[model samples]
Target: MPELKKQSQVPSQEDFARAKSKSRQFDEIAGRVREAVLDEFRERAPISSVWLFPGQDGDLNGYVFYFATSDVADSLESGLSDEIEKALVRKSKELIGSGCSVIFDSHESVVRKCNGNYFQYLR
Candidate 1:
């Protein structure tokens, strides 16, 4: 019979504490970024609401801007949606020192997709 060696590496309490601290720092930075982005969108875009959430890997941020169907139509007709998305990316990088994904959709679509499990910056 072959003998199997036990796994040797384990995280220490200090390692866990350090990881928790880093997570908190990231959260704080993300919060600031979210607020700044929301403010900019509200002031310039025709969005009805904005949802900010962690990325799939939890190492980045994601934003969803919801607009009324009519507002979406108007923005699209005027090529404002593309401009707003570009501006959002630039603003996010400036604020977080990194880039994030931004999604634009109608309010009804977001509410249906998110299932009321999201926080919106405006409503």
Candidate 2:
């Protein structure tokens, strides 16, 4: 006889409420970061997309900015990237206060890394 597979437990109402609250918090943080980035680099960079994910502690974890193409990603100077990061850090106290990670990469790279599980910021 084949062994029976165990089923996963469904989330309780309280668990669902907690998850919804966390999602709303993340959305607020992402919106602030998105606005700052767009205001600062709208004319300078061709950003394809942006994604944010929460950390294990349910705080803003990281920001991933994707350039439209590899060429666009490669064109940025290291110092400029650093400057951009610094500017972003300054624009949002929550990001700096939470010590969030920031990454700038090509769209293809991010898609591969995230495996289609991510929240993207739409303009």
Candidate 3:
């Protein structure tokens, strides 16, 4: 008789819950970062909302939380790095206060999870 092949194991409820939890965490973090970025950008120039994008193909391939505008999504794109820095610092504090280890990409992951819409820098 021929030996039967074993099937791949399916993810258990616990596994699925873990994934969901991670996703939820990402969303929360992303939302916070998005808001912070928008607030910071508003200090520099008029903005619409923040947009997150996944870096791909020789690009950063991570998450970029940025304000949007008509000019390449916005005229304030160049000024975003500073805003992101500020957001990170603030977020770190918040995370520390909450008694949680700020996991890697805690901010960026949130940006990516919001389908890249994480935050909007409205005018």
Candidate 4:
């Protein structure tokens, strides 16, 4: 009978400490990004309709920001503070291009659904 090798031991305290530090840093960065995106959304889109789906592994690891309508979505995505607009789009492209299907649902179809048409609300 062949004997199986023993599994590695749990991480040491020092290892855990290092991991905790890195986790804190990651959280700080995430908070900054969250603030930036949300602020931009509020400034450029309708307050009630804007939504920011914080990224996670299961949820496409990116946001699903939506507006009341496609027109609002487009304006938010393109007409917001130029700095924030560019940053948001760049992050989106990077996330999507990196094997994650991050989406920017403009709600164009939904807007038409409300009016019984298609692409009718874009402006």
The candidate maximizing TM-score is 1
Question: Could you arrange the candidates by TM-score from highest to lowest?
Answer: 1, 2, 3, 4
For model 3, residues 1-123, the per-residue Cα lDDT tens digits are: 999999869998999999999768765765675576566657764443443322223111123332332333343356444445546456535642221111123233444565534453111
Stretches off by above 4 angstroms in model 3 are 1-7, 53-70, 73-123
Clashes of 1: 0
Q: Residue 78's C-alpha lDDT in candidate 1? A: 83
Residue pairs clashing in model 2 are: none
User: Which stretches of candidate 4 lie above 4 Å from their native place?
Assistant: 1-7, 46-60, 65-86, 89-101, 104-123
Name the lDDT of candidate 1: 0.65
User: What's the lDDT for all of these models?
Assistant: 0.65, 0.61, 0.45, 0.48
Which ten-residue region of model 3 has the weakest summed lDDT? 96-105
What is the C-alpha lDDT profile of model 4 across 1-123, one tens digit per residue? 999999869898999999899667655644555456677666655433222233454332333435445554555556553444455555544443222233344444445564533224322
Backbone clash tally for model 3? 12
Query: Over the stretch 1-123, how does candidate 2's per-residue lDDT look in tens digits?
Result: 999999869998999999999779767877788678767877766666555555666444445455554634553654555665666666545553554556666666556766544444211
Model 1 residue 104 lDDT score: 63
Residue 80, candidate 2: Cα error in Å is 2.3
